[model samples]
Target chain A: MKINPEFVTSVITKFIREELNKFGFNRAVLGLSGGLDSTVCAFLAVRALGQDNVLTLIMPYGQTFPQDVEDAKAVVSLLQCRAMIIDIQPMVDAYFHRYPTDNPVLKGNKMARERMAILYDFSAREKALILGTSNKTELLIGYGTIHGDMACGLNPIGDLYKTQIRQLAIWLGVPEKIRNKVPTAGLWPGQTDEGEIGLTYEEIDKILFELVDLRRSRQEVIASGFDPKKVNLVWEMIKRSEFKRRMPPIIKLSSRTVGHDFLYPYDWDK
Target chain B: MKVVLVQFSPHLGLLDKNLDLHYQFIDRALEEKADLIIFPELSLTGYTLKDLISEVALNPRKNNQLNRLKSYSHKIDIVVGIVEEGNPGLFYNSAVYYSKGEILAIHRKVFLPTFGLFEEGKFFATGRNFKTFPTPFGQVGLLICRDFLHYGASYCLLAGKADLIIILSAAPGRGMSENSGFTSSEMWELMGAAISRFSTAFVLYCNRVGFEDGVVFAGGSFIYDPWGKCLLRGPDIEPAFLSLELELEDLRRARKTWSFLRDDKPEIILNSLQNLLAKNED
Candidate 1:
């Protein structure tokens, strides 16, 4: 379906409002990454829960680039949502110092989880639901940390793509600075999205829409005139991370299991 | 502060008998004056409800047993499974967060497992969104079995920012593992370990024990602190309760000591995760 952004926002806001009431909650919380997804979610949340009930946290590890911080502040200011910046460098440094791991990936992951911990702490105190900024692409690929950035009570953009977020960003009138900022995980200096992924989001999105939405097979995909390697690569990720999408395998000891047997989440009937 | 987890071997296709067992277990916890008491998933009704969930679902406004449990809420908070009427749906495996006096929260099972011998998808609909509820004693999160397995559950609780995650489970099998009779207990252990490590949230898992429909539950109720260290254990095949005291001071210290959620690199992971998402097809 070609969803109009306004229609989506209305449905999402309605979802948020009804969900909060249904679950006996009113407030919401989210980390403002100043990126397209979070920026878009911030605007959506402001519309959904009102700016006053929405608290945006900017968790910057000491090494965060100045622009990223500025952009985060810009989004919060433009959207008029409650925002705060919490420096996480000291906290992250302590873990590596104690364990002494040189693995940058592990350290980077540690940093991400720490940011979430702080967000949770704030949420704990604030009594708010964590609003997620993850879009469909990241969730499907298991791109976010398990409990870090991947953590949220509900994700608004988890079903959208990087390019889709960009579309929503422009539609929502996100500041040009944030909308145009080089997408980075902000792990270290001079790192960008293309550097790590080896393909631009534009190129990836077209492949994904066809594969995911159109349900095209590899031969069909290449037959349609795309690089075979890209098709193979994307398929491999889906095959590998398939576990991330479903419940972990549970050995059936009971007739019903939460994993393999009896499965359910809380408050589903509504 | 000590909590008792009763990993009971519930009778199959039995709700009234199982609830009677719940009363017995609660009485035992009260005998010990345990601060919190927990049970496995769907203990009130058998796990694999088929269609009986709708028939047996408790009407909170009318059900005497549920009301009795609500009255019991004043003594200790109970996290047990029950079927409740939900909007647009027939039944839910709900964790009625009740203390001795009143019901604190009602968490409908959201992640319906639909694979293998289990088929929750046939009955229960997944829950919407929820937050961690604050009790007088602590900030708590209630996630039914598979909910604990998903990143979504921890994310939701972590997003609500819960300090302690109580996973009321009916997880079966303790000795069987994947790939040619591997040990399933190890999987549960590793899962419990990873969940605690990742979220920095104290963890509690109460699994059922019994033999029904050829399914054997090895009741292994385990609790881990924020650092992924085991705090207590219960028998693998008994309708018994295990209790332990947790210091809020210790939790605060663990949060200070383990800063996993605070130091993250979101921008990079997001790119790597979604790189293919925006890709074009041939």
Candidate 2:
């Protein structure tokens, strides 16, 4: 779906400012992976809070691409915000050395969680909120690791689809090299998001825009010319990932449960 | 008559803080010498309050915060939104009209939207009536957010001979448009224009701005003349104070040129509704 980048930019910047200000935080920390999503978040965070207030952490594993690292550094220099490069290999390897495994998924998840741990650690170290970078497509398809890449104090781009984030990137004057680069999680060498997910963001976002946003049924989506297999796949992914989107369900023994009935706005009395 | 629209964000569940904000804006409006000032829906209690609704609900007849707001009306009229604690347990999303240091009228929101990002129906008691009250400016009719979407609600006000229809909303921004502004806001503007044109009443819409739990309120408030022409439009997604002097003559001229109100057939509609309801009961 098409979006007016200028309007999106204005609203998102305001959202960043207000969401942070309400929590008595003027600074933010985010894991900048040199990908389109994190880079866009970094730009918006800088625009909302000044460059001096945003801290970007580049956490790369041993197999992380060198170009991605360079791109992350380039973005930091371009935005002139604070940046720190912490090689996550030592921490990750230390954990895996005791319990070795070659499963890429498990190793990738460890890396993701490792980066998140550092982001939160610095979140307290700098007294800054953790800004999230997960896009709607990834979130909908269960592509992110829960409590890892999925965790954040506030998400500015969670509502935007991956395709829309690209559109926004162009409008925000993101570096052409990063914008045109093939999307990747940089979890391992030769890994691409589309290859791992088995669907391009363009295809996934279109399917999701119909299935989730427009609330189209599976048959209806298929009738609209999407492959039934892909539609079902996307549908299954959404249903499976529903748990990641919500807090852990609490068994209700009290009159009012925390998430079930004891509802209170997050910014209550702030 | 000069009217001021205060497009602001209210802190969630904080009555004293939001009341102080109202005083600041009222003071500013007084400095501008405006005849009336309006705030958005739940201006004193932020939207998206679930259990906090009861915690923030005010007893309009006895609350010190509301009385303080009423005191400001002695200098200039005030229209603000509040969670009115009705009977013992019934709480309504209500709008208060204060004039001459008294509570002139209260319009509890008739429509409580319950679907999709809104749980108002679960927390608020449904309002049962729509009535227009007299003010120094004109016969002013008040409606909350979802009430404005229901054309029949405005029709009731039109039937009551409302000269000015004021809508206070904390509508969240939804759906992106091709050019500018949210698509949901376009719907509000469309309704405002159609209502003003058909009823020949000055439509003044005041909407809030700011994010509450990630849902941003669209703040493109506006004023429309009786001819359905926009008099003033507020900024998008930002809090702003908008003021305009109403040309009361425009209302007279519009009503004269358009016979929509004069040739109205409320009796026929009422009789048909009576028959329909009778048949439904059968």
Candidate 3:
């Protein structure tokens, strides 16, 4: 479908406000990596809950780029929201030192999880909900850490594609430098999302729009001029990552299962 | 005529909170100068009230909770879904039309879906009739959620000379087609547009959003002109308010151009149904 940036932003801003209000929360918090997704989320949160109620945290590992940190600071300055920096190197390094591994993927997952741990502590202290910044493209193919970047009290941009997020970010007055920069999770040096995913967001979003949103068969997608191998590869990624999107399955011994038949309102007591 | 669709998620079993939100939306609609505002199915209570259905059931005459809503309707027309409490324990899933501080019409949902995720048939009594009432805008017809899915419901309203049809839905979104976004949302758009085109009447759809007992209602509230052109559309998963300026001339033009209603078919349908029912009885 054709996405209207203005309409999407307004809807997202209202969603953030209403969802948070339903949960009795007036404050919002998220890790700002100076990336397009976080920048857009921060801008929307400020619009929804106001600058005073939003808190942005910039957690940097030892291998983090200086420009990313500078960009995160610039975003806070522009948004006029409260921001703080916490060096996660000690926490990540302490764990790695005990285990001693050369694998960058393990280190990346640990770094991401460590940042979430710090964000949650701050969320408790400040009485705020952790706002997630993972976009639809990253979430669908398991491009993010499950218990790390995927955890959130509420997510404003989870449904939006990465390309759509950039459009929204530009519409929401995100700095040009941030919008134009290559997308990255800031997990490791020279690690771009597209480079790791093995496909450009524009291509992947089109494929996803056709395959998932359009509900076209895999053969149909392949017949639509896309490489059959590429289409099948994307389909496989979605199938494998299904577990990341759902809660743990319970043994259904009884008639009503916990997540199946047995369900309760999340705010039942409230 | 101007119509405003208030597409907000109502928390299950939260009567006070839902009523307060409705009041706020009413105030906002008045500020926007809407002639009528419509809410989703069971807006007062919620869609998934399995065992708690009777606990929050409202009686139009005695329930003081609706007093404020009645007062507001004096200024602008109001259409909302409610669990209508009747004769002690009897209850119904109904849509009430309020204007000038009076209950103009109440359309109890005729179709009580029992299959799949719906258990409405077990909770509320089925409605017996479908009616089009006189409104400041024009003759208007009302249908609740699944009621709109049945073609017979709309045919009755068309036969009654209704120029507008309002449907209140609490439908959960399903299926994500690659090009269409949400399959459920697109299906609704197609239905609303097709009904408006064939019936030559305006179609207003108001669906709720938010999670209720793990079921997320798709909020793609929209308004379509008689020509099947969408005037305004809302988001698929967010609470939104859409106010559109609807002129009666659109209906007049479509009816004049197509005259589908003028062709006549109710008598044929009535005769055919009789024969079909008689054969089934054997």
Candidate 4:
């Protein structure tokens, strides 16, 4: 499932440019988490709409990794795009202080949504479209907050798996530090994506490439030399996370409903 | 004969805007003095039109826009894809071959791909016939994207003595290859080559480029000669209006050399199919 990174890069940059142009926007805003996915998107966005047109928002919570923040800053400096450090700690903590949630997942989800809110705010202020950074792996497993990191005006890397994103990141000449780092959501201290997902992206991507892209059955994927439990887990995750990949289904009462018979393309008439 | 392939991205559900875009390209083709101009499937109404298909469906018999497009055929033979409203509620994904201010032929797409990312079967009525019409270049056959994938469709055209097969597609770009191009695009090229070589017909594929709800159409429109040699290829994921001078003499030479058409036994195959169908029914 390896991709021609150069071919993919050209397609994505053109996609970003044309999609944004269709919406009459020359500028784009994306949250930079110092992760490979976001970093690659930043590079592509800068390539499509000049460095001056792309804005990077580095929003870190109180427990966010310092190295990640540094890496994010490094990328912003490297790309020479507009960068803003908006600490989401106060807003997330303020909400938690009022709501009183001790659960890490709840806190993490709050942090993600807070960052999304700030990104949109900046998007409105800058009149730039918010570019999504969630890769296919995260999207398939529903590892992202529904309306948080998942919310964006356009996504250039949603079809690419985590492994493919790493491949693309390497081709894009992303920093070795950023490329080699363990993938994480940076929601809490000492948290890694593989740890939470119960499998490495390498393993997850293989199973997903079969189960999703190739449309292989769980048994067929296991037969292809994957661990049965992991294959089953990946299949289950894909099935369970279907909601995260789509709009909320509207109950159709009228002849033409928004998400039903009244379907139109997102770029319709624009 | 010179052929111009207008590889363009149509604004989804915007008929008038896409018409304007078509006119722009048509004018360009005319300026180049091309004999034929081909556009990708649903050139007037962008692909991925789910419910919007009905909104954009054109009755070619009476539509003013279609009439205007047909008017250009007086100057150059134009082949364009459109949402053809055959009857009141029945629509077909169709390719119209316009020549001399009249539609010479309308090939409704036989294979309406409904599975995977496509929902054409849901919106369009499946076409029944595979017919070829005479063109100034040669006898030509038209097939939409999915129709071209079914070898039987090409075979039917070959049987109809088609010397040129034009495929109009809004094929979504998918499957990355380790090498230079998309896996989906490679499949098209492979099929185009095989069909061209076997049928001894020039295969022209015109595919659109642009994102429709995140599914981007691969715009690697290409032309294959009668000998299955690629003459021209448009850029992937980008809009291009490419013109190619096709040596019509190549068709005569390839046909004489291979003689696949001359050595064909359609009668035996037809009899075999009829017997098989009769037996199956029994």
lDDT of 3 by residue, B164-276 (tens): 89999999865533333356688788889888888889999999987664455788898888888888899777779888889888887888899888885878888998989
Q: Is candidate 1 or candidate 3 better by DockQ?
A: 3
**CA deviation > 4 Å runs, candidate 1:** A268-270, B1-53, B56-282
Model 4 pairs whose backbones collide: none
Question: lDDT tens digits, residues A70-102, model 4?
Answer: 999999999999998988888877887889977
**Whole-model lDDT, candidate 4?**
0.90
Ordered list by DockQ, greatest first: 2, 4, 3, 1
Backbone clash pairs in model 2 (N, Cα, C under 3 Å; residues 3+ apart or in different chains), count: 0
Top-DockQ structure, candidate number? 2
- Which lDDT tens digits does candidate 3 get at residues A219-260? 999998998877887899999999889998988898877787
Top model by TM-score, which number? 2
Q: How far is candidate 1 from the true structure (C-alpha RMSD, Å)?
A: 24.2
**DockQ for each model:** 0.01, 0.80, 0.08, 0.76
Candidate 1 positional error at B224, Å? 60
Q: Which model is ahead, 1 or 3, in terms of TM-score? A: 3
Candidate 2 C-alpha lDDT tens digits along B81-198: 9999989789999999999999989999989999988899999999999999888888989999999999999999898888999999999999985577788889989999999999
Q: Compared to the true structure, candidate 1 yields what TM-score?
A: 0.51
DockQ of 3: 0.08
Error of model 3, residue B260, in angstroms? 5.8
